[model samples]
Each structure stands twice: as C-alpha cells, then as structure tokens.
Target: MTLIYALEIIGTFVFAISGLRLAAKKHMDLFGATVIAFVTAVGGGTTRDVLLGAYPVAWVQDTVYPVVILLAVPFTFIFRKYIVNLKRTFFIFDTIGIALFTISGMQKALSLGIHPGLAIVMGMVSAVVGGVIRDILCNEIPLIFRKEIYATACLAGAFAFFLLDYYTTLSENIIYLITTAIIIIIRVVSIKYDLSMPKMKG
Candidate 1:
C-alpha cells in the first residue's frame, strides 16, 4: 500500500481501538464492541463516499479497514484492564485520528474538484460522523457535544487545510501536517485548560 493509504489505515485502526475500549468500559459485549469499532473506523469514510458519489463506500470495497478494526478489538480486550483509566490518552489519539481524517477528507474532496466550502463540510463529516455514531451506539452525548473541542478541532483543521491549499506554497503533505497539528493542539490544550464553547444565555 502507498504511504498515505497506510497512514490512513493506521489512523482508522487506532480510532477503532479507542472506540472498542470505550464500548468495553460501558460493558458492551463482543458483538456490540465489534459493531462500535467497525462503525467508528469507517463511518466518516462512508459518509464522505456517499456525499462524493464514490459508491459502495471505501470499506465496503476493501476488506482491509474492516479486518484491521477486527484485529484491533482483541488487543483492546486483552489490554483493557491495564488501560481502563486511559481516557486522556484515548482522547489524544482519537483527536489526532480525527484531525488527520479531516485533512484527508478535505483533500479527497478537493482532488475530486469539489468546491472548497463543500470540501470543508465533507472534512467535518469525515472526522465527526464516525465518533458521533460511536457515541450514539454507546448512549452517550457525542464527544462533539460534551467536551474537548471535538468538531471545532476538526473544522479548524479542515479550514486550516483549505487556507493553506489556497494561499500558500506549502506541499500537500505539509498542509495536512500543519492542519492536523493545529487541531491536535486545540484539542489537547483545551482539555488541559478546560477551554470550551461558551454557554448561550437565555
């Protein structure tokens, strides 16, 4: 596989593991955990494909992503005890995964010659939808709604990517890296400092 594809695969697998671990913490059984992992890993890509008319979605066509997520489940199960209190670490990895996924989604849409604004939305969908589905399955408020700057981080990265592509001579990979880093920083720093969206007054 190409390097980019490999990075995406790793990102997907990590996100799936994080999802599976979360499911286990909620005492979900094997079937539920697997379902959560599978959906978390590919939900974003599925949405992106549907919106892009890419048909059948990517994970539907390739067994690789699904298989990777499947393998991740057991490892999570085996290590669940030692990692039970790793919420912060999970957030870090999950945030990074979405950051990269957001950039990748926007890049895919851009490469397809989609409009920039639409591409940004697609990027947000690609990063946020997967986690949203996972949270719904777990009967929790989606991370986007709860804390740690979730969707905001993804949107910020997506916009950063778009602007970098538009107004800079930066290489494509560099743009992705910068955008991902910005999202990661926002997410991590917010978590560290308790920063968040403001509450609206009635």
Candidate 2:
C-alpha cells in the first residue's frame, strides 16, 4: 500500500483502540464498545468528507477502514490487561492517531484544490472531531474544548505542512513525516510540561 494509505489505516486502528479502551473503562458491552470504536475511527473523516462534499465519505467507500476498526476492537479486548498496565496508553495512541490524521486529511483537501487555510482547518477537524465525539459519548469534556494543546498541535502541524510543501525541496513523503513528528512532539511536550492555551477569567 502507499504510505498515505498505510498511515490512514494505522491511524484508524489506534483511534479505534483508544475508543475501545475508554469503552472498557466504562464497562460497555462488546457491541457498545464496537460502536464506540467505529465512531472514534471514522467520525472525523466522515465529517471532513461531508463538509468537503466528498460523497460516500471515506469509510463508506473503503471497506478497509471498517475492517481495521473491527480488528482493533478484538485487539484492544485481547490486550486489555497489558494496555491497562502501560502508562498513558490511550494518550499515546490518540496522539499518534491525530498526528497521522492531520497530515492525511490536509493532503486530501489540498488534492481537492481547497484553500490552504481551510485545508488546515480540515486537518484539525479530522484530527480532533473523532475524539470530541468519543469524549461526549464517554461523558467527558472533549480535549479540544479543554485548555489542553490538542487542536493547536494539529493546526501547527498543518501550517508546517503547508510551508514545507510550498517553500521546501523535500519530497512529499518526507514532508508528511516531518509534519506528523511536529504534531506528536508538540502534543507530548505540551502534556509533559502542563502547557496550555491561556484561559479566560470569569
């Protein structure tokens, strides 16, 4: 498979795992967990596609997306014990997934001749909307709505991607790697140091 397609599949898998992990914590049944996993994997992409007027959406056009999520559900259940023992398993997976989704989504928009600014917004939406839906379903404040640096990281990555594509001589694949790394690093550092955007006083 192409690198972009592979990255998309990996993103879907990890996002699904993150959602399944939360569902498990909520004591959801297998069916409920699968539903959560499915939404977490495809919600953002679906939203992006619909907004862009890309009919059929992504997962609807590609069976691989659903298959990947199906695999992730069982994988999460099978390794629940090991995953629970890992420090910040959900955070790690979610961060990586967002980084991947941001670049992939931006690339899609760019390919469709979207304006760069809106492409960046699409990238952020693709990265965060799924998690937002997942959080709402889990009855928690979405990370993007919180003071955390979640959506900011995606926006930063998208901007970096646009600049690199415009001004640099780097290959497309290399740009993708750098953009993803930038998002992941920004997210990790922000979380590690308790950094966040300024909050408004009441």
Candidate 3:
C-alpha cells in the first residue's frame, strides 16, 4: 500500500481505539463502543471530503478504512483492561493519529489545487472533528474547546507541512515525516508540561 494509504489505516485504528477507550470508561456496551469507534475513525475525513465536494467520501471510496476500524474496535474492546492501564501509550496513539490525518488532509486538498491557507484549515478539521464528535457523543466537553492544545497542535502541524512542501525541495516522504514528528512532539511536550491555552476567569 502507498504510504499515505497506510497512514490513513493506522490513523483510523488509533483514533478508533481512542474512542473505544472513552466508551469503555463510560460503561458502554460492545455495540455502542463499536459505533463510537466507527464515528471517530471516519467522522473527520467524512466532514473534510464533504466540504471539499470529494465524491463518495473516503471510507466509501476505500473499504479498507471501515474494515480497519471494524477489526480495531473489537481488538480494543477485548483488551480494555490492558489498554486502559497504558494511558501514555493511548495518548501517543492519539497524537500520532491526529498528526497523520492533518498531513493527509492537507495533501488531499493540495492535490485538488486548493490554496494553502484553506488547505490548512481542512487539515485541522480532518484531524480534530472526529474527536469533537466522539466527545460530544460521550457527553464530555470536546478537547478542542477545552484548554488542551489539541487543535492548535494540528494547525501548527498543517502549517509546517504546507511550508515544507512549498519552501523546501525535500521529498514528500521526508516532508510528511517531519510534519508528523513536529505535531507529535508538540502534543507530547504540551501534555508533559501541562500546557494549555488561557481561559477566562470563572
């Protein structure tokens, strides 16, 4: 499979796990957990595609997307105990998933001749909308709206990808790697330092 395609599958699986992790915490049934996983896996990309007027959306275009989520959700649900114990691992997966999706989304928009500025917005949307939907469904505040550096990390990563693609003569593969690394680092560091955007006084 192409690198981008593989990234998409991996991102789907990781994001699905994140959603299922929350469902497990909420005592959701297997069916409900799987539903949340499915939504988390494809919600952002579906939104991005629809906004871009891309036909059939991504999951419909590639059966592998849904198939990966299908398999991943059950695996996650079955290993809830073990996975839940590894909070750091799950957070890493979440970081990597968002980073991958951000670059993939921007690449798609750029391929369609979209302007870099708007493509960056599309990238952020593709990265975070799933988590937003998942949180809303779980009756929790979405991460983007919270003090978490989630969406900002995505936006910064998208901008990095755009700059590297346009300014540097680096290969696309290298660009993708650097952009993803930047995002992962930003997210991990933010979490490590308890960094957050300022909020209004209560």
| Worst window of 10 by summed lDDT in candidate 3 | 76-85
Tens-place lDDT digits, model 2, residues 1-202: 8898899999999999988888888888999989999999999999999999988898998999999999987787789887745758778888999999999999999999999999999998898899889989999888688877989999999999999999999999999999999999999999999999988899
lDDT of 3 by residue, 7-100 (tens): 8889999999998899988999989999999999899999999999998898998888888988987687688677767988888989999999
Specify the poorest-scoring 10-residue window by lDDT in model 2. Answer: 81-90
The clash count of every prediction, one per candidate, is 0, 0, 0
Kindly list the per-residue Cα lDDT of model 1 for residues 1-202, writing each as its tens digit.
6545765787798789878888878998899889988899899989998989977688888899888998997778787765557776677678878887888888878989999999999999888899899989898988788745678888888888888899999987677678888988988888888888877779
- Candidate 1 or 3, higher TM-score? 3
Residue pairs of candidate 2 with colliding backbone atoms: none
Candidate order, TM-score descending: 2, 3, 1
User: Candidate 3, after superposition: displacement of residue 49 in Å?
Assistant: 0.1
Write down the lDDT of every candidate, Cα atoms only: 0.84, 0.92, 0.90
Off by over 4 Å in 1: none
Give residue 18's lDDT in candidate 3 (0 to 100).
Answer: 93
Best by TM-score: 2
